[model samples]
Target: MKMQRRSLRIEETLVKAFIYFSVICVVFALFNILWHILSHGVGLITWEFISSYPRDMGRAGGILPSIVGTACLVALAVAVAAPIGILTATYLAEYAGKSGVMRAVRFSIDTLAGVPSIVFGLFGFAFLVIFCGFRWSILSGGLTLAFMILPVIVRTSEEAIKSVPYEYRECSLALGATKWQTVARVVLPAAAPGIVTGIILGIGRSVGETAAIMLTAGSSLGLPTSIMDPVRSLSLHLYILVSEGVSFEMGYATASVLIILIFCVNLITNLLVRYMITKRMGAGAH
Candidate 1:
């Protein structure tokens, strides 16, 4: 019995050591990449670089237009996607309940999620840009990104909603509340963190997309005055700089900015989520 116990202890120690080593490797990899980018690019980040337009195909000037375009694309995509995704998730979680229709819907969403971004780009170029008369503009690009991120939002939100305690629903219903009321007041609030997390993930993916944005949004360096106007994004700008051999320094600079932008977005969204959760908890306590 003692020998068996010793062996078990040894096995447990080995498993724990492996887990810690895996974690260390992941963290090291992330920091190593960050260090490489920041070390090479941080020196190039200037106010002028951030606030002005590119000159001579991104070799001499700033990336203000690309930054603006990226913001517009991401915002428009998330704005269109979030409500629709959430509603679909709510329906799937609350109403679908083992139906053939649900199975088909799930299959479709899974397929969409697995499809390549380039395919989405092509579809957007052919459909929205050509067929729907949107043209190569923010509207077309944003819509394409929306479609790409929709599955992620729906899946994440459905899981979040499902994770909410059934007892919470029961309690709300017991207190003379309707189904919708219970969902709105209890379930949604509880799932807000996860939903926001999914939205953040969508935003991250949208920001980093180059192929889809390039084909759909167009790579014009001009500032977009309206959604119909063609614009360039940071990722596309970086791609042009590197792929076309315009400037490696400029490309690295753009990469640094993109990384910083994503970090800021994630930080701000997480803070907001935390605040919402804290406020809800305080209300409950009161």
Candidate 2:
């Protein structure tokens, strides 16, 4: 009995030590990244810098045009990609055959998810922007970003649609509904929230992307007056600021704002999801 008790105590102690060490390591990594971002970016984030454009390139510079261009890039990318992605997902989940072609499409999507962003950048530069004569225009960057987000959107949307109860589809079919009608009325609506979540995830990646946008988007750092014109983005600007030996002041500030943007996007998504859940609950209550 004494030997058994001693072994049990040792096992408990070992488990506790492992948990404590693992937690400390994780916390240290997170806090270190946050601290570095704050330490570099805190000093230069003034109102003037936020509003102004990068003047020859320095610490006191503003990121107005970059911000505006980044917004447009994200908007254009999402708009172009979301519809097709959702539709493709709808088809795959509801209509597509389980044939070799369909299997191939699924495999391609998986491959796309794994492809390096830098390779996408190279491909975008070589094909979309340069070979196609788009010349680093918004259209090229947006389309490239759209492709970058496609796999994400398709997978997420498919999962969302799949999550809809089979009973709903069966009832619609039982009522003499056509396939399209059943999917349109019964499946899509139920999966809307999941689709939205997928869209948000795609948007998050597109907005934060540096490598894929670098070659395609270019680094003009001016407000985007038109899609035909070259544009800059916040991530691209941050990269430039870091590599060009510019001060950390603007760099840190940009990092901070990027964090804030991500935080706000996540928060908004959370609230929207909560609202959706509450609405469903209310309907159930009724």
Candidate 3:
């Protein structure tokens, strides 16, 4: 009996050690990549580099147009995906309970989540650019990205909504609140952080996307005047600089800017989530 106990203890220690080792490896890899990009790219960042346009095939000047285009694509994609995703999530979690239709819906979302981004690009190119006649523009790229990120939002939002305790819904209903009122006031408020997280994830994917944007939104360095106009995103610009052998210096600089942009977005959204949580807590206390 003592020997078996000792064996179990050794196994547990080994498991714990393995987990710690895995975490350290992941963290080290992340930091190493960040160091590499920041070391090379940080020096190239400047007001002129940020505010000016590419002069010689992205070898000289700034990435202002690419930055603007990336923002536009991410914003448009999130705006389109968030509402639809949230609503679908709400339906799946709150209303559709253990039905065949619900199962099918869940299956579809899962499948979509696993689909490659390049495949989405091809679909968008064929459907939106050709069939819908939107052509190669921000509109097509944004819509394509919306489709790509929709499943992520739906799955995350659904899980978040489900995580809200049923007791909260019951209490709201007991207090003479309707189903919609309970969901709107109690459930959604509780799930806001998770929903925001999903949206932020979608934004991150959209921002870093290159292939989809390349296929749907033509690589135009000029600043886009409208959604109908083709635009170049930072990821695509970086790809061009590297793939076409424009300039590694400019490529690294663009990569650094992209990283900074994503970091800022995540930071801002996290702050917003904290504010919402704080406000909710204060209101409850009052």
Candidate 4:
């Protein structure tokens, strides 16, 4: 009894130490990144700077165009990819594509997700921009990004659809409802939250992507007034700032914005998810 008690106590101490170490490590890294960004970006985050246009060496320049371009690109990618991704996910999970051709399609999607971003960029450049004659425009890049994020959204949404309570599906089936009716009415409602999560993740990935957009989308640092215009995204801006070393200050400013934007997006989604879960649980209880 004494030996067991001693062993339990030791184990408890080890677990506590492990937890503390892990938390401290994460905290340290977070603080380090924030500190670097704050020290550089705080002074540079003026409204004027945000509104102004870019100039040589970044000493007296702004990222107005870049910011706008990034937003438009992200929006375009999301709009194009969301519906396709959702449908693909629905088919994958609900239908599972029994036929040989459908199976091949599913296999291709799986493979696409695993493919490197650089290769996607290459394909986009060659096919979408050159041969297809879209040119190095925002439209092409946004489309490429949409294609790249499709696999992610589809896979995540498919899993979410699958995780819906089997009882809900079974009850719908028993009600003389067609598969489509059951899926649209019962399955979709239950899986809506999860599908949204996948879209959010796809957006997040799209916003952060650099290499793929770089090759496919012309990063002109100019405002994307139209879909055909060559534009720069925030990630593209970040890459540019880091690469040329023309201005470390701009790098810091851009990094800070990117971090803050990502945090806010994630936080809002988390709050929405929590509220949804709470509402669902309350409804279930009643």
Question: lDDT by residue for model 3 over 133-223, one digit each (tens)?
Answer: 9999999999999999999899888877987768889999999999999999999988888788888888888899888888999999999
Question: On TM-score, who's better, 2 or 3?
Answer: 2
Model 1 spans > 4 angstroms off: 1-25, 268-286
Instruction: Assess candidate 2 and give its lDDT.
Output: 0.86
* lDDT (C-alpha) at residue 109 in model 3: 94
TM-score (C-alpha) between model 2 and the true structure: 0.90
- Give the candidate number with the greatest TM-score: 2
What TM-score do all the candidates reach, one by one?
0.87, 0.90, 0.88, 0.87
Per-residue lDDT tens digits for candidate 4, residues 13-46, read 9999999999999999989888988788877788
Candidate 2: tens digits of C-alpha lDDT, residues 126-221: 999879988887888888899999999999899889978788899999999999999999899988988898899888898899898889987776
Q: lDDT tens digits, residues 1-286, model 1?
A: 9999999999999999999999999999999998998889989999999999889988988999999999999999999999999998998999888999999999999999999999999999999999999999999999999999999899988988997768789999999999999999999988888788788878988999888888899989999999999988899999999999999999889999999978987897788667766765775685
CA-lDDT, candidates in order:
0.91, 0.86, 0.91, 0.85
**Residue 71 lDDT (model 3):** 87
Minimum summed lDDT over a 10-residue window in model 4 is located at: 275-284
Extract clashing residue pairs from model 1: none
Model 1 TM-score, all chains together: 0.87
True lDDT of residue 256, candidate 4: 79
